[model samples]
Target: MHVKSQRVFTRLTQLKELILESDLFIAEYNLDNIQFVQHAEDLLIPDGKSLSDLIGEKKFRKIHKIIEKSFKVDLRQFEYYLPLLIVNIIGEAILTKDYHLPLDIFLWNFAKESEKELDGVETYASQQQIMQAIKMKDQLKMVKDISKRPYIYRKNILKMAKWYEEESINLLYKNGKKSLGKYKHILLKKRNFIMADRFEELTLNQKSFMAVGAGHLAGQHGILKLLKDKGWKLKAI
Candidate 1:
């Protein structure tokens, strides 16, 4: 117990340095104010039950009928995971309407053109593992809830576009954190910590330009704060 307490204390002290110690640093600029445009997507669990098991028998039947008529898909293969299907379909539709090549592709291309070594903080496999950590039932519930919030989805997309235009990192951070809520621990903080540690290591060897999802730039545990804690200087450009 004493040893555990010591470890906890050490972690808390480090966290304090990242969050509260910035007051003493004159060179630290607010990276959260820089608005960057980006995009991200979530992974769906491969395993799911029937639509009736997920939603309800009557509602599932009604929804399945509607979906079949509309999209002509035989839902039996996916009926068990109706929530996941619904959310994914909705997400794709929205993204399609506003779709362009992902910004990261351009960034990657630019880096290649510049003859810079390319690296990623985490691999696609690691990201999948992180996403798989979410409870499947909770994932279903979240998607179902999201499906009911069309206005919120529209609002979020508009907010993202506006933030990108204005370079409002703080507003993007605030909204993204709110949207993730409890899951932010997995989706944002954990990934941010890993990325920050890797970034610190890379910067030690050479100057590097890191482009990541905008959501990873804000909040207490965000990469900017993590870098600042490591004594890296941040300048607003």
Candidate 2:
């Protein structure tokens, strides 16, 4: 076998060993962890930004002009908050005219109705810590690049949504890893391991439902594979 495949086999073997040795039971999972709502509101609902907070007034004006010319958005309205604006763009594209509640919140509400416990893998503080670690320069560059290909923003969203509904794990894994380069470790791997550990501890012998982002269920380091390694039987429903 090639080195990469060999390594994957080794990792899977190791996970099998861990699962065999552990005492936690593996509960069933959904076809895919759907996240119809992008949580863009959480990012944009905070206080407004100022020109100084974004690089500087001069550079901000330049970038804002470029964005306005290309996307026709009033950046000054958001105080040149590129990340939140980009998020809003994607959210708008995906959401379109739909008015349904986000699947995660819907599931949470259902769990509440059933009197089941609700938990998150990490707290809001930890999530913010991860978000704050990304450099501002990278964030700006990302926004600029996406701005140039604005149409692809929605195209990719639709493609992922289709792939997700189809439960195409391999395609989802490939695409999920493509966009998240340096941020992958903090956003995906570390959180997946932490959540897997938490799930093991919390589930024990009880059955539970975990509604995480669809991306979290893909890739070798994803939560599903990680849990599978720990001897959890995951069947699509």
Candidate 3:
């Protein structure tokens, strides 16, 4: 849900239809809730610190160079715009003229929380390893390579979804066989279990439509699999 102008109406219509059919509508975060919005804003920019401050000037400058070179996008146009780019890299919804806030805010907060939690216990060696990984010239080259492929909309949506899901899982759990991996595990896998618990409780008592990021839908520890393992039968619509 990257807020492309062409797909906004289509996505809106689909959401309306789903909402009409369900007694309860659950999203990753309740975008319309003011309290949640405040919380997310605080989490994303804690103590009024910018992304550069949180990541450090040296690391941020290096990352900025990597992204600019790899993606060929100029980030000098605005302050705090790097978060938007980072969000895009992580597959979170992007904010655009056609879309509003809160919807695009939660994931940034979630990502920040993951980093903070990891930072609490990350060893200096592990931190160095993560920084090295991020600073690699080819760190984001794979994304650039993938973007070059021709993809027909709708037809390629499922395939793209599967690819993103697998990549997310691998980054968080499989390839993450280190502290960075643990951070990803907390961000996605652990969060999936928590979300599954709440989703299970809600569905048991009422008809519900739960909308989550596509990345949370598959994988061994994904919400759907967790629910299925708990004896709930699942049927794809």
Candidate 4:
């Protein structure tokens, strides 16, 4: 569901209506389970290694400086790394109400027990690294520039959908260095198939409402296409 809305209330209302109409709610993560915390830890300190070990100590310090300058948060005091902290800050800025909270907290409260997490911890960790390597600056800029007239967030989402849907082989970047994009292929295409397989298994005997990011819905290797190939009839509501 690609919601092109500037109003949070409208989006929440639409989401609430869908949840009330559905039997089961599926999400990218299950906030109610222990696995969510496990995934969070894996992203911040994978395999019990610090952020400096995953990305070089130099790069980690650079990112730490950037965070300190941009968000006024010092990494030395926080247990988590840059990616998780940036996500929390952006979620708070966009979803503010009296006090700040992680975006997952709102989703957890909204859907409660009906929400079932889909992606494995390893896959989630890999995607977070890929995002941090490639688009962290652009993401932060988007949030900073969000209030400007003629919002481009929805347009950028559509453009990315087209790129993924067509399976474009353009070179991707990691921390300002160009790469062959192999990680994206494995993390995105393979994970789509995995999610599709799980979705099919989940819906074999009952109705289910699967909610994934927009990028996972329209690609040639996307979950929706994978499910359709397996003979599941889908109709957008």
Candidate 5:
């Protein structure tokens, strides 16, 4: 089903109230047991002799020394390599390259999370490197920029819905971690909001755009069952 939106910041009901009244809506981006990260073991591949391998104890120990030595040689220049290695180690958790997050947030986050010690108190990168690395259509930028700056990055979500493909974004939020719970709900709402934005593209008439945040759409029940139940003869166009 396809659920479309009207305005950017306005509540979706202002655009289409009947869409919610109909509950038998089928939408995309529903959260099923996709198993993104099941067991901690799943995150670890044997570091035998491959890029995909997670180096065992001996190799793991050496990484610190290698990075430390690299930094000693030239701390300022090492940032490029550091973030790359960090992203590699974290399994490319960032959704996309264009995710619009403040660079400082990521720098602080990586230092705290991975090493458990914040490094580079006040350091950033050359604009050259940042612009160079920011490629790959920037889905990560989409989320990051969204979270960091709502007024500026909010519209990107609408653009994403317009140009979407089969590979819809999958957000992995920190639900059980700190104040991130509230933020997680926001992310879910944003996810649903995006689906709703792209509702008109679903192809099926009287369609529904399913997404992660049922809560956001849950309250808008008016539109959910409005189509078929009301005998609108919603069809596959």
Candidate 6:
């Protein structure tokens, strides 16, 4: 890593440490942890630039811009905020000489983590379209009753909820570290499709965060475990 990158990696690690340390009080995250983390101003810069500059200013800013909208945080016009976050994260990784993690690893892991949070995503075209057409004029209960036809099942209802959950997770985490194994056998290929969709924005070797749902982060087939199996270190902070 370059001199600037080293600093950013170190800070990233420290940020991780802070989150892990504080998660104990949050009930596996009782509230939005981002609000509690250091503000952008906290990651001071010289001449006003955080470490994200070392990577690429546009990329750094773009990531933050995406986050600002998704996270709904009101970041100020202060230019240093995003770079500081990147620098701090990079600093954490520099603790060990071998701590240089692959950019693809991070991006891929982020996408995976994201899917874990999205429990299920619906294939409405496959079911809802036909079901709705059959009962276009029916009342809510009547529509639901018609859904019981072979076109839809208790299984379909389960899938709808899963879709909502998984998408929610993806929107939040963007880290892609969560797992999608829970729905593996139940939803099978549908689950696979969502995981792949989460990182369509990514390419091989590009490093980026993938905000996903927290519920997807645990379990044996989760993103963390999957990444470890594929040979990437899921370091603490």
**Model 4, 191: alpha-carbon shift in Å?**
1.1
Model 3 misplaced regions, further than 4 Å: 1-15, 34-86, 89-182
TM-scores vs. true structure, each candidate: 0.65, 0.69, 0.51, 0.55, 0.21, 0.23
Sum up the clashes in candidate 3.
0
Off by over 4 Å in 5: 1-30, 34-37, 40-59, 62-203, 210-237
Best by TM-score: 2
Model 4 C-alpha lDDT versus the unseen true structure:
0.49
Tens digits of per-residue lDDT for model 2, 19-40: 3444332222221232422343
What lDDT tens digits, residue by residue, belong to model 4 across residues 1-237?
A: 222223223345666677666666666645455456544654453355554555567866776666555445555555344444544443333322432333334444566655543322224444555555545444333333432321243344344434434433231112101111434565467667877887776767665666565445655776777888999787764
Estimate candidate 4's RMSD in Å.
8.4
Give residue 72's error in model 1 in angstroms.
14
Overall lDDT per candidate, in order of appearance: 0.55, 0.58, 0.46, 0.49, 0.30, 0.34
Better by TM-score, candidate 6 or 1: 1
Give the distance in Å from residue 10's predicted Cα in candidate 5 to where it truly belongs: 12
lDDT of 1 by residue, 1-237 (tens): 011112113233333333232212111111221232111223323453455676678866665565455444445555544353455454434432321323444334444554556666766556656666767676666554544555576566655655755667778778878877778788888888988887776556555566577778877888899889989889864
lDDT ranking from best candidate downward: 2, 1, 4, 3, 6, 5
Weakest ten-residue segment in model 5 by summed lDDT: 170-179
Model 4 segments more than 4 A misplaced: 1-10, 34-63, 78-105, 113-180
Model 5 RMSD vs true structure: 18.8
Candidate 1 has its poorest 10 consecutive residues by lDDT at 1-10
- What would the per-residue lDDT of candidate 5 be over residues 1-237, giving only the tens digit for each residue? 011222111233431343333322332322121133222222322232222122344543344344334322221232223222333322222123332332223222333333332221111222123323444224223322333454332243333333333222221111112222334333343434444444533434443323222233232222223333334454421
Order the candidate numbers by TM-score, best to worst: 2, 1, 4, 3, 6, 5
Candidate 1 colliding pairs:
35-167, 49-80, 50-79, 50-80, 51-79, 51-80
